[model samples]
Target: MARLVYQPQSPLNATLAVSKRWATSLGIWGVGAGTAALFLLSVTPLVKREFLVKVPVVGSYYEDKTPASDKPF
Candidate 1:
């Protein structure tokens, strides 16, 4: 009868597997963050400004009756 032998798993192999999983997780998180930033940029305006108004009846007040964005929402 002939003897059979099998090699034991190495620490390097386990380390490599763990590293692969970590890289994949970071990639997914980065993609999600990028997509969220892009959506926010598209839906919201880049510039925002407001000015104060003086009226006899209203006294001093801010101009918030209309939107501050250049384009209409």
Candidate 2:
């Protein structure tokens, strides 16, 4: 029978370089996806509509709070 060659069994060995590379790629991918999600959540139309207000020239035009003519002053 042929003698077996000695090989390293640790996860950090050169034999597992592909797995380590894949892990790094996955980390980068996750970061990119998270950043994209944050950007979309901030700039999406629904988010903008819910958070932002449409002001004409000066500022926001809210409803009047003064008493109406029908009510006593």
Cα lDDT tens digits for candidate 2, 1-73: 9999997678667657877779988999999998777557855656445543343552233323457976675
Q: What TM-scores do the predictions have?
A: 0.34, 0.35
What do the candidate models score in CA lDDT, each in turn? Answer: 0.60, 0.63
Report clashes for each candidate as comma-separated counts: 0, 0
Q: Model 1: clashing residue pairs?
A: none
lDDT of 1: 0.60
Which run of 10 residues does model 2 get worst, by summed lDDT?
55-64
Q: Kindly state the number of residue pairs that clash in model 2.
A: 0
Cα error, residue 57 of model 1, in Å, equals 53
